[model samples]
Target: MKFCLALLSLFFAVVVADHGDHSDYVVKTGEDLARYRDQCVAKLSIPADLVEKYKKWEYPDDEKSRCYLKCVLESFGLFDDAKGFDVHKVHHQLGGGDVDHSNELHGKIENCAKEGDAAGEDACTRAYRGALCFFKENLALVKQNVASK
Candidate 1:
């Protein structure tokens, strides 16, 4: 009985740890974006004015801003330096796990992924390209998705 209990505890621990590592977060609000932005700004020591301008949608196209977006994407678990953005993850988060919306976003994500791939070798640059494409192509949807409730 003790051995069986120990095995159960081990299984539970593994499940919990795995869940913690791959947190299932849905970035569906301005608050969600703000949290990631604040964390990234602090981590990268990004200038306050730059963040303000970005909040206003005046994307800086600078190194710090580029990497800042990359950091934000990473926080959302939608991107990584080596793998770029994860389309399925982005679609699920932005589409609210709706299958219909997922189908619609897949094509756009793929197109943006292609653009990102063409954006040279800088991981930051690639992230920025993909992010920019997504926003530009789906401005209304993107805005609605990130609008604070």
Candidate 2:
């Protein structure tokens, strides 16, 4: 899935704060992200075929994939049902804690959240939608960041 591929490209060197015990997940390198991905895959019981497809950047629009994105986002302290998305957390992580860059990233993230807003949908669906929008909006920057890493 384009969305999944782009979303995965967003991670770099950042440690998520403790959101009730989610402190253990610190995504400083690709290895840490892979560890969390494995955990989410096992926790959700995602199929081997699906995992393989995802690795190839082919995401299926299904519950498992959507929930997988949600799990990843939550692990990064980027999203939740109650808070929707922690824009500040994401800005800090992706913006490298740069206050001067805050407004630009913050506005982009806010717009994406609005684009993906679905009050009637489930949390996983909402998270997936928002992530899709977020990545699509920031694809170039994400690619640059990924290349740097």
Please give the CA lDDT of all the candidate structures: 0.79, 0.69
TM-score of each: 0.75, 0.70
Q: Which residue segments of model 1 deviate by more than 4 Å? A: 1-28
List residue ranges in candidate 2 displaced over 4 A.
1-28, 143-149
lDDT of 1 at 19: 49
TM-score of 2: 0.70
lDDT of 1 by residue, 1-149 (tens): 99999999999999887544335655556887888888998999998899888787667789998899889888878888887777767776667654353365788887897788764579899988988998888867777777833
Instruction: Compute the lDDT of residue 139 as modeled in candidate 2.
Output: 59
User: In terms of TM-score, which candidate is strongest?
Assistant: 1
Q: List the residue pairs that clash in candidate 1.
A: none
RMSD of 1: 6.3
Which has the greatest lDDT? 1
